[model samples]
Target: MTASRISNTTGWLSFAGVVAFVVGVFNVMDGLVALFRNDYYQVTSQDILVFNFTAWGWIWLILGLAQIAIGAGLLAEQSWARTAGVAMAVLVAIGQLAFLRAFPVWSVLVIAMCVLLVYALTAHPRTRAYPEA
Candidate 1:
């Protein structure tokens, strides 16, 4: 890869990392509230598009943790982070869809970010990994 492409890849990965970290924090909080204060969602488990609040809470918690770890790994340039970032970002987007009814705007925003993360991770494979000598 050219020097500029290498730099661009790193730039995109860095952006993915930062954005994932921020979004993960929100997911974590959302998970906690869902677990503890189910009423906060203002909708019963049945009302949700998918699983119950408790189940959803655990899902969000676990996914959020995964996102945080992926973000950190990307920042550290771990070899596995690129694939993980793409996978996790896709999951996050799907998860957000389930969350749409509860937080329409936030869910849409998160989905958008996830798409960007996916793009950043997939734009160039060689750049995502160690460049050829």
Candidate 2:
């Protein structure tokens, strides 16, 4: 790969890492809140609509770990990391759909970030430079 391509790829990867880290931090906070108070996300009065606190806690924790792993991989420019990062980002996007009430704004932000990250990761500049290496 040419130096320019590598440079651009690194740029995108680094940006992805930073963004992921931010999202991860938010998720961690959400998890902690869930752990402390099950009623933290009481946006609905319907008994069936309410999510269990422990379940949400686990979800947030798992997603937080995934984000951190993807962020680290992107920062390091690992080939497998890049692939897994894409998968993780997509999973995060899909997961957010059901978690709209818990983190409405953050869910929207994460979806937008996932869209941007996918684009940046697959862009010609980064693709040409990195070549999956």
Candidate 3:
């Protein structure tokens, strides 16, 4: 690849990495809150889509750590990170749906971010070739 093309790819990957890192941190905080203060959420345990607050807490905590590791791997330009990042983004978006009742706005925001993160990781800028004069 040309230098400019490589640069562009790197930039997009970097954006993905940073977003993954931020989202991971957010998940960690959410998990901690659920674990410690179940009442902090807007809904009761029964209202949750799948599991109770404590279970979700553990899920989010583990997912968050994995995301953080994926983010770092992406920044390092590891090939596995690209695939893992896409999977994680999708997983996080789906998880947020389960979490929507607890924090509607935050869950939606995270979903949006995950969408953008997926795009950044997957989409590549088109290149054009020109004939030499």
* Per-candidate total of colliding backbone pairs: 0, 0, 0
**How well is each residue in 1-133 modelled by candidate 1, as lDDT tens digits?**
6554334346777888887787787788878878899888766788779888898889889988988998898888887988988888888899989888876787898899888888887775453456668
Q: List the residue pairs that clash in candidate 2.
A: none
lDDT for model 1: 0.82
Candidate 2, residue 115: lDDT: 82
Per lDDT, the best of the predicted structures is 3
lDDT (C-alpha) at residue 52 in model 1: 87
**CA error at residue 110 for candidate 3, angstroms:** 0.6
For each candidate, give its TM-score against the true structure.
0.82, 0.75, 0.89
| Candidate 1 Cα errors over 4 Å, as ranges | 1-9, 125-133
Error (Å) of candidate 1 at residue 65 is 0.6
lDDT of 2 by residue, 9-115 (tens): 55766787777777777777777887777676655323323466677778888888777877787777767767776787788778777677665887798789878
Could you arrange the candidates by lDDT from highest to lowest? 3, 1, 2
* Best model number under TM-score: 3
Pairs of residues at least 3 apart in sequence or in different chains that clash in candidate 3: none
Higher TM-score: candidate 2 or 3? 3
Model 1: lowest-lDDT 10 consecutive positions: 1-10
In the order shown, the candidates' Cα RMSDs to the true structure are 6.0, 5.8, 3.8
